[model samples]
Target: MLHLLTPDEIFPSLPEVDLERLQRRGVRGLVLDLDNTLVAYGGREAAEPVLVWLREARAAGMRLCILSNGRPRRVRLTAERLGLPWVESYTKPRRRGFRAAARLLGTRPHETAVLGDQIFTDVLGGHRAGFVTVLVNPVSRRELPHTRVVRAIERLVFALLLRRGRIDREAWRLRTS
Candidate 1:
């Protein structure tokens, strides 16, 4: 399941990915989910650590762009503030948003990676779009009640994978990190 990343997943919290690794994976572009993945949903600006990561990723020569399901005003303001290329009203778990973002990035599906905090939206959409998918744990535990319910479902999905012996924590971290 896309919910689980490789064992190498690390923290603060980068999977320790950089340009060399991305190139090795044949990835030249990135599609990022805004909330929880890059910043907390309620945040107006990305955290300093996230900004540093973004800079590091860019310096490594990766073409990064943001794709979010948020409304036009929200997404646009965030993108403008961050100086990032972005699309608003992204309907994740569907191919349209991914496809549009890919086109805007001038990236082929084969050379793009889509990363987000939610498996149902981010991972599924990226996987369906034929890009490499990455699912990161959400940064915030405090969320709306609706979001909390989805988080529960997400955990259940991961737990099922663990019980099936498809994932072991250490192995998962190593692959992702």
Candidate 2:
């Protein structure tokens, strides 16, 4: 079955995340989601938190790349300015995007982690492609209208999980690799 994990389980608290722990988890590469996961939809650049995370990840011998269902303009601009590799117009829940990102990482799906803001697309797609899926809270609520709808679905699922006690606040971790 597809695993349901909250942001805390997937990445630890944003403040507590570190490259060393990720390395211990055997994640040598990362394919990060844009927009809400990294920044808001209207975000013009990576925020300070994201910048710090990127630096730490790189410093710990981890590679990073951008993969999103967003336009080439946003992806390219961010990727270029950050000097990181990326795949724009990358369709999630599809192997193409994950495959491209895997190629860029020079790592197999099993060794890579896909961090994102949605479950249906980000988690499902990453799971399908065989990468470890990490779900995170969206940074802001100002997402595209379509994303808002998906988020509504997520809330319903989260509520169900909460009722069933499937959500573990202390040990927020799920792995398919």
Candidate 3:
């Protein structure tokens, strides 16, 4: 169960992810979390750096899809602004949405990567759906009240994982090899 919530890799931010490395590892598509991952919660647009990184990933022949639990209108508009397709209003920590996003990208589970800031949602769902998962630190501390509560639990789980050497706090890449 803990492994289901464990991210395959960790990066400080979306822009820090190595697109080339992911491509070499056969990651053909990216299932991205919009809020807190690409942009701050409630922000209208992703920062310029994130936009540039996304463009670079697309240029590298990697497909991208926004998979978010946010409202449909907000998710749709954000996707449009980023000029990407999106899967919105679907609950996370569920395999259905992750599979849908993978299908949307025309990639099999092994060929897709899910990137988000939350472990319980993105990491767990991606793992359940059999896709590689990458976790990034949240862009901002500002978040929904319920999310704040979840964050507390997330911290506890992370601590346990860290202590057990299942996760490395100092290492940006969590690969065992």
lDDT of 2 by residue, 9-40 (tens): 45532324555766777888888888777667
Worst 10 residues of 1 by lDDT: 3-12
Clashes of each: 16, 1, 0
What TM-score number comes out for model 2?
A: 0.85
- lDDT for each residue of candidate 1 in 1-177, tens digit (9 for 90 to 100): 534322222223444445466678888888888887787877778878778888887887788888998777888888888789996645777899899889988999978888777767877788788888765666666666887898778677766666776667753453234
How far off is residue 129 in model 2, in Å? 0.9
Q: Which stretches of candidate 2 lie over 4 Å from their true place?
A: 4-8, 12-16, 169-177
Off by over 4 Å in 3: 172-177
lDDT by residue for model 3 (23-106), tens: 887999999999999989998789999999998998999999999999899999989999999997468978889888988999
Q: Pick the candidate with the highest lDDT.
A: 3
RMSD of 3: 3.0
The residue-level lDDT of candidate 1 at 59 comes to 80
Per-prediction CA RMSD (Å): 3.4, 4.2, 3.0
Q: Which ten residues in a row have the lowest lDDT in candidate 3?
A: 168-177
lDDT of 1: 0.72
